[model samples]
Target: MKIAITADIHLKQSKDEAPERYNALINIIKKIKDEKIDKLIIAGDLFDKEAKNYNIFDEFVKINNDITFYVIPGNHDVGLNQKYFTANNLQIFNSAQVLSFNNNAIKIFLIPYSADNSMGEVLAQNEQQLPEKWVLLGHGDYITGQSTPNPYEPGIYMLLTRHDIETYNPVKVILGHIHKREIFGKVHYVGSPCGLDITETGKRYFTIVDTNSGEVTSNKILTDILYYNENLIMLPVEDEFGYIEQQIQKMIKGWSLSDDELTKVRLRLKINGYTSDLKKLQSIVNDALKNFTFYNDKEPDLTEVNVLKDNERIQIIELVKEAIEKNDKELGLLQLTQNDVMEQSLHIILNKA
Candidate 1:
């Protein structure tokens, strides 16, 4: 049987709703039905925050009715008592249980999420010999060290380790918590189907597992409502503003964003040269980059630096220029621009006569 596996669906309903997320999810369901997949498995995080929307169930009813869906409640969807799901063909597993299918050919060891340290107890209590081709599906922070709650946030979560999995020894373990797709041994972290935030860069995908052969494949899906590209350009102290502009353009020339895509390019120009009017340089770059439609533009890190101070300005510039020409020499000119020396120079040049 062919089964589609995806995680971190993060569905929600709001006044200013995100249609792209819903559309991406709907498209996946369509693809599964079109391909004639037998079952759909969502590891966790089907809802964005809380499972408040009854409309999502109604929406699922409109989709394929034949395909069986197995959903494990993630941290976001774990607020209420969703022990049993009676919508469409949805099956909710809120606790640890062994789910059998295809005349016992496929066994799914479902470990639902728990905020407390009760997961260990559940595993220990339900310890039994799994089938030959059993898969472990759960939602928790699987980490050797500490758990990062989200990609951008810093918070420790209830953690599990590879050693914990080896103790159980399933053929494959599919987890849902980390937003980045990663595979460690037999455990697979199926990341979010869509880029939830700008911090989540690169393409997003879902997994298609062939239960017959044990072959897992990734299917890339486009779910980005906005495209964000952040680049840090290093330059050898150039006095010409146009040179910086040219370099910025050259660096971002590889972007193939559609005209309708909301694109944000944050150019952090770190230069170790002398230039007039830092504001004007920023204005020039901003105006030059105005062709791209970004939702929000941040103040560029315009580092027009002077390695020398006071009377030694010209001498230091010359020295910096010579060092840059060497190319072979690691002068660390870019490093100097990021430190307090550049800030001091900015104060001296911009604030003084």
Candidate 2:
């Protein structure tokens, strides 16, 4: 039997975000249908919170009636009622249980997260009774190699150790709770199906496990909503104003923005030298970007400029130059005539000329 597994869908309805979260999940389900997968397992966190919109979820289940879905409640889905999902093909595991499928071909030791009980106690009682050929699906903070308290869990729930699973020796272990896809020995944390935050900046996937051969694989999907990338560039101390502009242009051009995709880009520049027209430089950088919510952080390095053995008037000129060369690195400011502290100092020395 071929089973498709994903976790942390985090479905929520929001006015600011145009229901893309639901759409992204529908796209994944469509792909699964196209692949003719037999079963779909949502390891945990099917909703960002207790899902209040039952009608929308019912609609989602009705449209995908061909596939059976096994869902486990995550930490956020604590106290989520099975009545919210009214599909005959749906199986909700609100607590620890065993599920058998394919004429005894596969057995799943499913442990859903509970705010009331300790997961460690649940595992200890049930793991020893696990069948020889079975998969362990759970939601908790799992530590491998060595066991310790996960700083994030505090006292909300108890953690499961990888060593604990090894004793039971399940064929495969699939887990959720962590938002980044990771593999520890025989266990897998299948991450979120879509990016939940700006830091979740890479491609996402759903794992496919073949029950016969006990082999695991993944299907890569392109995310069309909410993308982010961050980069840092350095500017030399001797670069001229025009050279600085050219360098900034080069960096911006290097980023490939899709015409149809909305992406967020962050650029940080650590500048070493000086330039006179700082305000103008910011404007040029702002106008050069497209299809990006641009943000930049630029810092001027005065350590090198301060070491120059020049007169106070000449030093002021150098400082203004530094500001101009460091230009256009911050987002949102477009004024081309506003003078900074160093620029005002330059003006004072030049008698407002």
Candidate 3:
């Protein structure tokens, strides 16, 4: 009987409320107390809109009051009210929640966040029938016209269709207001564990329902901050500084990031074409991207690099000496200085005149 799903952790009410989003929920409650798991579901925005700190989320539910933190109310905390948060271990689900674990041998179903009923009209005010392998949590927008939008609420609040998961036949339909990770077959969304921006990139999760083999997994949550965006294009030939040092070593080996994981990377580099040497291509892209720290915070945008002047460097050096004399007479090779070595590599280009 395991349970530890999460959601859009917007969490902010200003008071320096973002220590990497409460330190990624305090490392998912210290890996749910080192997998001694007690229960921690939070299928909603958990606060970000008018975030009233709630005593900094009750100082993280008083550290660990034996881990029991169920919360609901997405669309950025819509109609929230659990006595405005005091956290006697934090419960806060306004309505539609029928939970029972290990004792009655697990029986789940919850639905909060209702800016005017839609989640099957609030589970049809609980007719209490679905319990045979049932399991469905909630937040909003489950397909049919809106394929995962809600980056921070822009329309539609609570609407989970698929005929309400085929008329509440729930086998596994946990959800949260789309921050990224998504699935549709059995419905799942457990996204935003970190990287709340830069389009929420790689690795971050918290989902693990298995209330007696209904099965659902995913636990990874080592987020301190990660985001990358790379783009390097420069080939006005003549080995443009060995093609910008071999495309910055293939963009730092496609970010296989080592060297101490490069300080939790937040890169966003972009170096466009044509650089016969713009200050040695900005010193080989600032010494191989100087271990990124610029997610648009500056540099690495050489105004679309364009150095070759003088009539476009004599028409691209006579179109690369007519494609190297048509590949030197179809590879027979010959005594060719190759147009004085393409006019000595466009005379070591550096003419801003």
Candidate 4:
């Protein structure tokens, strides 16, 4: 049996910002249809919020109408005092339920978000006779120390750890919620399909699991088309403003951005120098955005700016020193004194200014 697993497809109605991510998702669905996968499991976070965006579900349903789609409610899908509708082909497991598809030679034990029940207990209670091969589907933290409640926990912290999976040892544990893709034992968090925010940088992908002869083989599929570029410029103490602008222009020339693409571009620039002049740096970044997308008649859009003040650097150094001192005391090294001793024993953080 072939199963395609994906999660955290945060589909938003706003198109001007995330066109690439949306397009990438549509392409991935096409790939899934082409592969003729038996089951498509969206572990969690299908919607960004349970707002009035029912059309998002419509678009999602239209894409995967042919395949058997199994969904589990994520923290984002549950609202405080609201009701949201799920799609037709979508089987939402809001509670502890074991759904078996014997005709297709597939069996799925659905364990949804439960605040009052322990994960181990739920698995023990729902334990039923299994087929030749089965897949366990849910969304939660699969690591011990990394289990954190979702932002919208609704007064209940329902999290699972590695121990829960060990007790209910299924052929494959397809999970979600932790955005970083990782594999531990038989459990796998396929991670987010596309980069949702700036925090989700680098490569993002999903997984395809092939269950044959009671064995499961998983393959990762990369689907991220957007690239985030961050540049930190430490200006010379006495450098001219034009010099910084020229440096930014040089950097922009080396990238794949064009003026038309500048409006859609997401870039962050950090400028650190002796002078308090920041307008020049901002203007330079804006100009670079304009120049790249100039042919397309799009304005350069700068996402963020981090300007460092003279005292801010010193404050950071002091904070680091205090943190180190606290850590040393916690480690049973209370006798250590003197800044030099601390700097020697521990690493001293220097302020650039």
* Best of the candidates, TM-score: 1
| Tens digit per residue, CA lDDT, model 1, 233-263 | 3223444466567756764564554443324
Q: Which stretches of candidate 1 lie over 4 Å from their true place?
A: 79-86, 103-106, 118-120, 146-154, 226-231, 234-236, 239-280, 297-353
**Candidate 4 lDDT, 95-197, residue by residue in tens:** 7666654455546676665545655667777776544457777766665654444443334335566777666667777777766677776777777777665
Candidate 2 collision pairs: 274-321, 274-322, 275-321, 275-322, 282-328
Sequence-dependent TM-score of model 2: 0.69
On TM-score, who's better, 1 or 4?
1
lDDT of all the models against the reference? 0.63, 0.64, 0.74, 0.57
Model 2 agreement with the true structure over 264-305: per-residue lDDT tens digits: 343333333334444544454444443345323333222322
* TM-scores vs. true structure, each candidate: 0.73, 0.69, 0.33, 0.60
Model 2 segments more than 4 A misplaced: 13-18, 145-158, 229-231, 237-288, 294-353
Q: State residue 166's C-alpha deviation in candidate 3, in Å.
A: 20
Candidate 4 clash figure, as a count: 6
